[model samples]
Target: MEIVQIFGFALVTLVFAVTLRQQKPEMALIVSLVAGAVIFLLMLRKIGAVVNVFNDLAARANVNLVYLGVVLKIVGIAYIADFGAQICRDAGEGALGAKIEFAAKILILVLAVPVVLAVLDTLMRIIE
Candidate 1:
């Protein structure tokens, strides 16, 4: 149901944007940006649902919440970075989009380092 609504909304927005793009490029961009925001807002519920599931699983597994927080941060960064890049690309700034993607990757790596170190430590202890 949500996917169907999303697709329908996107289709309508595209048609409108296409019609407006030739006469007014700025207006088309505005329309597109607004549509993107609305779609993202609509999908937040689903994202929250997934996060809840993961939280429950982590609780049952007795894993450290710090790792879960880090993972959620990474996922959040990925989504935000992708959204920003897409917006830049839509505005005809592919190079800027690429830079945003690179920054996102670096951030993700930095955020993941602590978890990676913890895992390595655990593995070394097991071997010893």
Candidate 2:
């Protein structure tokens, strides 16, 4: 039911944007941006509970939280980059969107270096 309503809202927004695209390009862009933001906000309402569950699991397992925090940060960066790219594309800047995604990939890789190095060191120790 809720999904249906979301689809309905998106459809309405799409039509609104399409109709306004020619006569009022600015309004159309605004409509698209607002629609994306609304959908993101709705999705974020679910993300909070997932974060809490992850935190609880890490605590119960007595695992260090630093890794969990890094994972969450990576996910956050990906989502933010995706949102920014989408917004740029909606505004007719596909090249800018691609650059945003490229930067995000680089940042993700940089942030992941520690994990990668740790895994490599562990593997070397096992081999030795």
- Candidate 1, residue 67: the lDDT equals 100
By summed lDDT, which 10 consecutive residues of candidate 1 come out lowest?
A: 1-10
Clash count of each predicted structure: 0, 0
Task: List TM-scores for all candidates, in order.
Answer: 0.97, 0.89
Q: In candidate 2, which residue ranges exceed 4 Å CA deviation?
A: 124-128
Q: Give the clashing pairs for model 1.
A: none
**Leading candidate by lDDT:** 1
Error of 2 at 121 (Å): 3.5
Best by TM-score: 1
Give the per-residue lDDT digits (tens) of candidate 1, residues 60-113: 999998999999999999999999999999989989999999999999999999
> What lDDT does the true structure give each of the candidates?
0.96, 0.92
